[model samples]
Target: MSRGTRAPRAVRAAAVALALAAGTVVAAPPAGACACGGLVDGPAYDTSVSSETAVLQWDGTTQTVLLELDALSNAPEVGLILPTPAPAEVALADPEVFRELDALTAPRAVVSDHRWWPELGFGSGSDGAGGAAGVAVLGEVRLGPLDVTTLGASDAGSLGAWLTERGFQLPETIQTALAPYVQDGWSFVAARLAPEEAATFDGTLQPLRVTFPSSSLVYPMRMSAVADDTQSTRTYVLADHRVDRVDPTAEAYEPTVRFAGRVDPATVESAELAALLRAGGFVTSHEQVFTEPGTEIVSDFVFAPAAADVAYTPTYSVVADRRIGPFFAGPVLAFAGVLALAVLVIWSGRRRRAPAPTLAPRPAGA
Candidate 1:
């Protein structure tokens, strides 16, 4: 009992208009090269002298990072290595580069993630009043208050161990404890007491705050998922190059994406889904379609280009109950068809009655 293909002509016209608008061409980025910096370091554990901050390098740029470890007092060893097996279509994997990352952090905690904020004209707390905006990291951790300046190797190790241990537990259990409280792109400072520290009398220990550098780059992307009649969407945006925000709730979604190459129009599936949307009683202000064209940017790969931009004022309404106006011509066409049939029947009858005699008289006069 599905009423299909009933979208008004106006709706189809609006969709076409959107397609025309997005038709404007755009410049494409170099293909197959990570236009955005790729990963340089890893999932490896750092075991060496711990210091204030560690530095990791990628693309000749150093990223200062910090780790919250386990054990308040143990043989002070801190290691910071970038995780490995980089994403496909990008070449960021270099074990040697990660080793160099380890060498740099032995003397310091990687503070790059926390320190780079000021350069964007966003000033940190140290700057006097009326300074640029600043974001705090490891400020007040669940373990306790953390200080970024004085955080040492021992503190980093304690925090790391605590997180690692929790991760090792049952996956579901781990998620249960953290899922409700965790936010993507969120950084936290965590620590655990060493065996000796654990042996001490039960008491709360002070948390250490740490400072790390942050990148200015932010990329946000949107993707949708549908199951049966219900639909869901998720967005991934780089909070900084190092941090990403993932929002599951259907809220605002806009990601400042790095302008990669334009994809081909052929790659875009079809407007059928969009048509289905209209039939399902959803109205967008505009509709457009795109396709992927043939161009070898890489081996067996091509990007899908946008066909056009859609300008739409959203209107969500029920379609089943909409009333057709009297001025609508559909009913008029049905009425006219009936009237024409009646007129043809009447005219045929009159012609049959008079035609035979008229034909005989005309023949005689001739």
Candidate 2:
């Protein structure tokens, strides 16, 4: 099929179109790969740091995903490892959906001039699933420019050896990092640029779309522990309710909540994303910190059903009063004081200028 073909019409809003518009799925960088399926930092410093964006849409117990990955051109080999809650159907994901998401959720420099007497305001700025394994070769399939395989590793040690044995050039630390998820019974999606398409591999790797049975949305991230330092992640969640906040599960930094707002289905431009957001839901963006070797977040994401009759508020906002109270409070209170002083000064000035009260005119002739 042509690259222009859209994803299944029904799922367009929930997810983006599946497949690259032009060339096959490809990328560069030796990303040891993230347990959450992110690209690991590699020696290829040719390009500046890369950013990945993933889209997740859940229907009941199943989820549709699109992960946008970046790679370099002319790289002989490039591959990715993604852990899943259960078996996954792998295919090329659309790049357009990412454009829509970036467009809708990208941070805006909101200049809120909350000032004294409408004078000024302080500016505010805003911002998966799967299963187990054995030496088990679950399956292999080809989706466009990608050669895909489903893998199951018995344990961390064996899995490391297995990847090396299979010609996957990566470090031992990555293997050690996988221990947690491997011990917890998670499966993986392994993909590489097809040999024939390697030469033409563009920098933008066609996001691989994976669908599977996930009781809750989750991205295996326990393996990211081997990362040299905390990894920065920004994720856009399109779900029925706002996702819960990220905390210091491991030694990683806390996730920053960008925004929790109603989804504008029309803005996203994906039928699937639009419908899903329109159903009384939200699209939340987050900047998170995950320490290597372990994560405070068990799964990258888990669809959190909005608690019944419970009002939901952003935790940061709940504490927002404290945030601006001191900064703006002083200014506003000072402005009030100054304004009061100005009024008093004006009254005194007028009284003094009033020709000594004029003695009530001739009525005081007595």
lDDT of 1 by residue, 1-366 (tens): 000012111111010000000001111111100101110111232111111111111211212111111111111211111111111111112122213322321222222322211123566601111211221222221222111111112232332333333221112222232222122332332222232322332322221212233332111111001001111111111011222222322113322321212123233233422222222221111111111111111111111212432222222333232224533344555677899999999999888898454534566557
What lDDT does model 2 reach?
Answer: 0.50
Taken over the whole model, the C-alpha lDDT of each candidate is 0.20, 0.50
Model 2: per-residue Cα lDDT over 1-366, one tens digit each = 001111111111111112111111222123444424433222342211244557666676777677764433222333345667766777765567677766665555443443433326688500001222446677777776655667777777766555545444455566655676677677766665455654554334455677777776554555555554445666666666766533234224455655566656676666655665675457666656554434354444433544432322243211222124545565677777899999999999999888754555566556
Worst 10 residues of 1 by lDDT: 13-22
- The residue ranges of model 1 lying beyond 4 angstroms of the native Cα positions read 1-137, 141-157, 160-213, 218-335, 351-366
Q: What TM-score goes with each of the models? A: 0.21, 0.62
Q: After TM-score superposition, what is the CA distance of residue 256 in candidate 2 from its true location, in Å? A: 1.5
> What's model 2's lDDT at 20?
12
Model 2 per-residue lDDT at 253: 44
- For each predicted model, how many residue pairs clash, with residues at least 3 apart or on different chains? 69, 34
RMSD of each: 26.0, 11.4
